[model samples]
Target: MNESIHVVCTHCHAMNRVPELRVGDAPSCGRCQQPLFQGQPVALDSAHFDKHLKGDLPLVVDFWAPWCGPCKSMAPQFAAAAQQLEPQIRLAKVDTEAEQALGARFGIRSIPTMVLFRGGQELARKSGALATRDIVAWARSVIK
Candidate 1:
């Protein structure tokens, strides 16, 4: 089995090597040395969104905006889900406010929408906020 998995840095856009067997282990960016899970979602934009989605990894993208109450409410839940699902899934966030083109391309009609992608293909997507348990279960169901 592979001991490590590759993850692109959400901040600096650098690739990282994290131990696949140690999902609970806190990993830092080898280039930026920042905590991979810092209690805040990793912000994404069109600049690197396609690369992340198309990578050989499972990714969860939250389409959110600062003004959306439901989106704000779901932020922590998404973060918790990421901590639990690490080493298996990559967590990402796209600010619909900032990335209008991306939001339009994804046809995001509502805030707090969640999309799961694997190998560049969208696996599942849903609108509204979900609990951590539900998010994990949903992701597990779609994971190959």
Candidate 2:
């Protein structure tokens, strides 16, 4: 029997069951018919955050604001990290400015904070901008 994993759709927030072997085959959401992993960080708001957090794959979320210099500088690196980390991990972004409640809920006191979650629980958190390599390494280390 093939093992399956639950991946939340980034576009529609629908839950999807993907065979483990086909995770890298570019799976699509059953409800919305959108690609499951788009190779980039998905922009999330409070409405869709909880489902993504509860997915079987680990979730890496960057809490950032538009005016923060470090956050601006880290956007490209975060995007690049998404390319390297998807299928195994889901990378997402929450604009703190637009989602103040989420930021507050996560106890984010600083911009450019990256939080890793698994099974709807926070596994680890880091505060600062990280290079693409560092982002991948940090997430991998935490998940391991």
Candidate 3:
């Protein structure tokens, strides 16, 4: 038998169990019938952040604020990283301006922080802007 993992839907934030081997085959959410990974970062708020953390796939969260220049400059690179990193990993963004509580909870002292989580636990964190290639490389390295 093949092992399976829980994948959270980017659209409805629903969790779906998918076979490990079939992850690349484009799985849909059982609850929402929507694609699980859309090659774009999911916009998350405090309400839905923990739910994503429960997923088996690693979650890379970009904590950012609108007033922060580096955060804005890194937004596209993060999104591009999502396109290259999805189906195996998930990328999300939290607007610190709107979710101040979350920023405080995560100890976000600076903007454009990338936090990686697996099984609802934080594994690693990176702060500052990085190019799309660097983002991919860093996430992969941390995951390994």
Candidate 4:
């Protein structure tokens, strides 16, 4: 059997065993059959945040609230970026209203903030909504 990484499906919260080497490839949830990177961000509760921070791979989290205009506006672009960047990065979302603790710990004072983390450390963060290209560019720059 090949060693694999356990990726938590953001859609159904199922654990997916993905080939370790294919972390950058387009992957789908085994049970849900949904694209792991459907391009839209995955909602991350506090538990999910904690679990993924401990992961060895890089993580991209979008902290947004549903009611925020900018957040809603950027949704499609964010999703597109997630879809294109799957496998190489894990995309997640933290609903500021739902995950209050996470928002505070991360010092999020605004909506539509994005943070890139690796090995439990924050590599970079940006506030305000951004386009899909900008999102991918930022992640790529910081992850390198």
Candidate 5:
């Protein structure tokens, strides 16, 4: 049997399986029928966060808050990184203020922190804001 990839929908929190070779074709979720990668980071709350964590793709989350300047500055960079990193990775954002429990659970001490997860495991983490290239490089390094 050919290998398959498990992708959790950021739009509807649905789990989807796609053929490994077809991952570059912009697959949609079977249940929600939404594109799995939208070329942007998905905003997630605590309730929907764990669903992506369970997926097969590496999950890169930007933990940020509205009141933070650095977080705001990093938003566009994160979005650009999402456009560059799709299919191979899933990018998301969690509002620290809205999801305090998740921030605390991850021991987030600063705004604009990024955490990378795969197979429900924390692979790497970075704090503070970074440019799009840096984000892509860091994620690719961790994946390799």
Candidate 6:
């Protein structure tokens, strides 16, 4: 029997069971018919964030704000990290300016904080802006 993994749809927030072997085969969400891994970070609001946190796949979230210089500088690096981490990890972004409640909930006292979650539980967190290589390395080290 083939093992399966659960991935949350970035477009619809629906849970999908993808066979582990086919994870890199360009899987699509069953409900939304959207590509599951888009090689870019998904912009998530509070509601969608909660749903994605409960998924089986690890979620790496960049908590940032438009007004924050460091956050703005790290945006492209985060996007590049997403490209390198997709299919195995789901990368997401939360705008602290737009989702004040989420920032309060997560106790985000600073911008450019990256939080890693698995099965709705926080596994690790890092504060400050990181380059693409550092982001990828840190995420992989923590998840492993």
RMSD values for the candidates in order, in angstroms, are 2.5, 0.8, 0.8, 2.9, 0.8, 0.8
Measured on C-alpha atoms, candidate 2 has an lDDT of 0.95
Give the Cα error of residue 132 in candidate 4, in Å.
Answer: 0.6
lDDT, candidate 3, at 54: 91
Candidate 6's TM-score reads: 0.97
Each model's lDDT comes to 0.82, 0.95, 0.93, 0.82, 0.93, 0.93
TM-scores of the models, in the given order?
Answer: 0.81, 0.97, 0.97, 0.80, 0.97, 0.97
Candidate 4 lDDT tens digits, 5-59: 7776767767787888776677888998986655556777876677767655589
Off by over 4 Å in 4: 1-6, 11-17, 24-40
lDDT of 4 at 121: 93
Q: Tens digits of per-residue lDDT for model 2 on 38-131? A: 9999999998999888789999999999999999999999999999999899999999999999999999999899999999999999999999
Off by over 4 Å in 3: none
Best by lDDT: 2
Predicted candidate 1 versus true structure: per-residue lDDT over 1-144, tens digit per residue = 768766777678777767776545767888999766544456889999986765556888999999999998888999999877765687889999999999999899998899998878888998899999998888888895
Tens-digit lDDT track of model 3 for 44-110:
9988999999989999999999999999999999999999999888999999999999999999998
* Each prediction's number of clashing residue pairs: 0, 0, 0, 6, 0, 0
Measured with C-alpha atoms, the lDDT of residue 81 in candidate 2 is 98
For model 6, give the 10-residue run with minimal summed lDDT: 48-57
lDDT of 6 at 22: 97
lDDT of candidate 6 over 26-60, digit per residue (tens): 99999989999999999999888888987878999
